[model samples]
Target: MDTLHIVCPACQTTNRVRNDQLGAHPDCGRCKQPLFQGRPVVLDEAAFERQRTRSELPLLVDFWAPWCGPCRMMAPAYEQAAALLEPHMRVAKLDTEQAQALAGRLNIRSIPTLALFVGGREVARQPGALTRADDIVRWARSQLATA
Candidate 1:
């Protein structure tokens, strides 16, 4: 069976999971934590780098600041999108306020930016808030399809 490398959200361990068992709710081999919690993992700079570089799965990151209204408003939709997308890909959130240097390095000039990363490099980016879960899913999938 085909397998993919997944980074555990809880402990940052890399796990090899069978493709067929993706929807089976796989657990991390080393950490014993559920691989997919059907929600976006809250990321610090170190965790973001670990997940982006170590996992074979594509990553979708939301760059937001706490004071941004659109970012706050879109959080619910992003969470729903995570529920629909996990096990196939990873979804994460990074607070610009919390990771200032990382955010500046990434050149995040705006709040509520969605960036899709494959093979540890950003492939596509969308700048703005998407209020609907369906829209977020569609946009991310479409970006992956093109990438």
Candidate 2:
């Protein structure tokens, strides 16, 4: 069976998981913490880069500022989407307010932007809030499908 490198959200350790075991509730080799938490992991610039570059799985990032009302409104929906997408992909949130340089590097011009990454490269980007979980999932999946 093929294996993939998954970055542990808890410990930042890299683990190898079999292709067939992705949905089997795999644990991190180093931290023994569940790899898929069914929720989005909060990320800093370093953590974001590590997961993006190291993991074989696709990454969905929500870039938002704390003061942005649209971002606050979309948080719950993003959380719901995380629950649905985990085990197949990794979901994370990056606070653009805290990581201004990183946000600038990504050219994030708007709050509540969603970017999907595959193999360390951005595959698609959507700006503005997606207030529904289904919409977020549908958009991410569509982008991944095309990628």
After superposing candidate 1 on the true structure, give the runs of residues whose Cα lies further than 4 Å from its correct spot: none
Worst 10-residue lDDT window, candidate 1? 1-10
Q: How far is candidate 2 from the true structure (C-alpha RMSD, Å)?
A: 0.7
lDDT of 1 by residue, 26-53 (tens): 9999979899999999999999999999
lDDT of 2 by residue, 1-147 (tens): 799999999999999999999989999998899999999999999999999999999999999988999999999999999999998989999999899999999999988899999999999999999999999999999999999
RMSD of each: 0.7, 0.7
lDDT of 2: 0.95
